[model samples]
Target: MSVTAITASTNSSSVRGSANATTNCLRLRRSHILFGTEKRYLSNQCVQNFRFTKPSNECGQRCIRVEAGWLFKGGGEQGSDARLERSESANEDILIFFYQLDLATRVQYALNLEEYDIAKQLRNKLNEVEAEVIKQREMKRGSSSKSEAQDKGISLLRLRADLQNAIENENYSLAAGIRDQISKLEADSLAATIKAQAFEKAEFEFRLGQKVRHKKFGYRAVVCGMDPVCCETSSWMENAHVDQLTRGADQPYYQVLVDVHEDPNLLVAYVPEENLLAPEEPDKAKFDHPYASFLFYGMDSAGDFIPVKQLREKYNRPRHEVPYDPQQDQTGDDNA
Candidate 1:
């Protein structure tokens, strides 16, 4: 073989090998493109299958994985559909947490309210019990007061009845004793009544004064003096005595001078103080004039008016007739 021919042959063989290698490289690139197109179509088909699965239990898990990958790659479907599903899950979790917290708070509030209501009920019951106790005590006091009043009234009535019986039977000693008892009762009752009245008047601001009516006396007398009279003999005589007088003998007499205001011609009459009233204003017209008049025609042996002292002596004297002497009559006839 020539050198030129061998070199041409080598060059031709190299060109042919290079041409084959280039063809294989083109074939591998075409295969790679086809495989990539197949993968893209499979991914699109998977998405379409997920849309067609109608949210069943089995398909839901697959949908979650596919959508998660798509979101990580930042590609596919604008993410609106998958976002809706994720939002629903998040909302469900939030609702569950809210329910738990709300239930716990409600339980605590209910317990507090129940305790408050129980406390209020107990307070009201205590108030009722206290009021009942006060009412019972008042009732007991009223009953006791009524019984005491009834007993006292019965005793007073019996005492009064006994006093009346003693007075009717002329038992002076018994009557006097009863009178003392009655006086004591009256004083005690008066004192109690006065004390009660004073207490009432203090609260009500009552006035104190004498009250009167004009029909009878037209004036009221206040009890200015309450002096009790002494029962001694000396006090009695000092209060009730007449004048002591001496007669012709050694006998002394007590004469009381009586007053005759309306009649000057009438003399003073004497009486004992026991038989007379303490000299109040008297009716003068009743005593001054006599109801009947007697005129005597006898000679004026005494004056027309007779002193009360001598009237008793003259009234006791008997009438006497003058006797005629016979010797005196004969001597007178001879002289004639």
Candidate 2:
């Protein structure tokens, strides 16, 4: 009987403990349901507020919360989904700024290039101006040199004219002095020319028995027995015989001969070597006959042979009685 009573007591206590556990579980379930509903309402309000606010107004708040959540996730906070979105936007803004800055730099560079081109063109123009200035300077130098040469020529011409006037007026002393000056100038100027030509002035001294040609006379013997007083010295002169008929009574019959070629018979006056020149050859057709030769031959009053053209002229007169026929005796003498 004692064991049965103890068992009954244990059963009752177990039932009471089970009933209290069931009540406590039901209350806990209700409290959890109420808490879940409150959480859902808070989530909906947060979504609404995020959607209604302007991007400029909500960006800061949204970024803060999103960033906090991303950090809590701990998958490299900067590279997380929400953080990546913000970084992309920032990158776009940076790209736009760089593009604008690049465009502005390009425009400035183009303007600088244009200025450089203009400067190059100006440099070319300056070079042309410098070349023109050099050309003008050279031309001026040439003109000045020409002017100086012309002035010198004019002075020389005036001096020559003055000397000529003095000579014409027979101012012997003045003319001589001026001539000397002119000669000196001419010698200075012609020094190189004279050296090149190897020319010499005429000397008064001459050799005896030397064969010389003259202007009027053809050829003759040089007789050196006679004496004549000349400008420089006494010269052994050339003498030639002339018929008395050919000479005038007042004329000096024994004329001194200088150049034999001027007149073979020494009929003409003696001329200095400075003034002497060769005579021109006669035309062959004009005097080709024996009569022409005879006309030049010498003869005396009594028909004697004399070494003179005057004697030939006095005796051998032109035969007017005869016709000028090639077959006729042109001298009108039929003695042959």
Candidate 3:
């Protein structure tokens, strides 16, 4: 036999092995996503353009590795396009597949684990995955008929999605710009609520020490406080930036030490009232915050937070003085 024939045969076997491995990985990833505790969404818009087969149990109830690069959609359903499609979407597929796996397999353990560093790494992975998912959806939207059909008219849905994505990705500069555009589009809505109002208004009624869920920031801690209070002096100001503090003066804000954050000790949020909502269940979730001890002396039988002795006394004492409203500071009042 010729040397070229032997070398070609060897390469063929290696390529077949690699293709099978990729298929198994894809199968495992699909199962993980389908049975996830908190299901991550898979958009039909993503898969609609492509034609693919379901995993077959005929393969010994084991993995059904589809033929090489069969999952990818190439233009026109023809020949060498197979090779080109693999090269094109390989990075995107790997990123998305691993991202789905992270959502399914890593999150529960990440939350349960006590080790700070490992949990943080897991959380950062989750954030990256979530950001990728949002970017993918946004890109899909941009390429759809809807974007083209708009003909320069504003799509508030797209704008809102982009704004939320920017905020979640910590793109503060971009968020600010998007926010300004949204305000302009919804100027009438803002004008309606622009009359006399309190510095902070609770969209949902809840007191301090209650458990609540934030639409963006997830579970635990409801720290209701005076608007624009000086948290820079407290441990609760760990992730608080000037932009976050000054961003939503017209809305109520909750001061919270978010549990299971990258830095549980320092990752506090002044979440806007609009973002706050009741937890899925009424049973209060026990959260451990480093500053909780300083703020609460102990929990009562019903698990309510109790203020420290000296702290409550200082506030309860009568002062023949008007209380300071930090929200007024925006109107050029500095005399706190």
Candidate 4:
């Protein structure tokens, strides 16, 4: 069982009627099973009950139970290891992202200071990070590169033809191998087709470069990319308590660039659709993520980030026009 230690103090009066009476102080430490992230804290009233009138040293340390019901709550006693492993994995992803952000920031600083040598080295590292991000995305989808529909169809047909020839030649072993390959190719093709349909239907709730806030964590972010459903590994899903979400892992997930001003530790977050909300008003303030300049052109009048051509192309997204605002135009004129 998951546990958290809490200490409470109890007071005792010895031989109350005697002149030489002395009071004894006893400290009690209790362990409670911490279930979910949302409600981990024990209340003051719960702590106060630990103060016993007849305090005993033997009872100083005891184990208690708490009914934890929140998002990502494990199923039972066996879930502890899964939860722990998941947490460690998340930490690794965050650390890697942090390193990339640091590199990008250093590259920008070097350029500003006219340190060409340092900037070149940092920029190279930043490029590595960019490539890694793309590779990781493809890995999640079980593909090395995005292939066109015609290419996939043609490949499948060629494999099937090879399988047929092998079978006709009485090459049983070769035919079996070809048959397995054909099955795998068909499965991949089907998955790709479904994903394409999802995109074509516009199933995503948020658009690329749109500003949003996390409903639970309340951090401001901009949508960078999205999946029809969570594409993270099983271990990552367990650690993130993705199963605990209202819509579960079957719902859309977004790749968001978090506002560094709000949370420097969290520069990027893969969040669920239900957890994101659009801002009621346009926020024209500067966003401080390192990837902001790399992935986007600039903020528009509506306070939304304008995605760069490359970023839009990567996600097959169309160009977005900045909403016209007379007040913004007037402000620009006044500044001029």
Candidate 3, lDDT over the whole model: 0.39
lDDT to native, each model: 0.26, 0.28, 0.39, 0.58
lDDT of 4 by residue, 1-336 (tens): 111111221221110122321233323111122211111112321111111122233332233333332222222343332222222222233334444554555566667767676567547646755676667656454353235444677999999899889989999999999889888888877777665555445477888899998776666889887777677778778778887889997778888877766655454577889989998888777777766776778887788999877667666778988767798789999999
TM for candidate 1 is 0.18
Q: Worst lDDT window (10 residues) for model 4?
A: 44-53
Find the 10 residues in a row with the least total lDDT in model 1: 1-10
- Point to the candidate with the largest lDDT: 4
Tens digit of per-residue lDDT, candidate 1, span 221-252:
11100101111134333332322311111111
- lDDT by residue (94-157, candidate 3, tens digit) is 2343334433344455345443444454466456555655555433322222343342235556
Per TM-score, the best of the predicted structures is: 4
Sort order, lDDT high to low: 4, 3, 2, 1
Ranked by TM-score, top first: 4, 3, 1, 2
Report the error of model 1 at residue 191, Å: 1.6
Per-model TM-score versus the true fold: 0.18, 0.15, 0.28, 0.47
The deviation in Å at residue 187 for candidate 2 is 7.3
Clashing pairs in 2: 215-279, 217-262
Q: Which stretches of candidate 3 lie over 4 Å from their true place?
A: 1-204, 228-248, 261-266, 309-336
Distance from true position, residue 86, model 1, in Å?
87
Given candidate 3, what's the lDDT at residue 189? Answer: 38
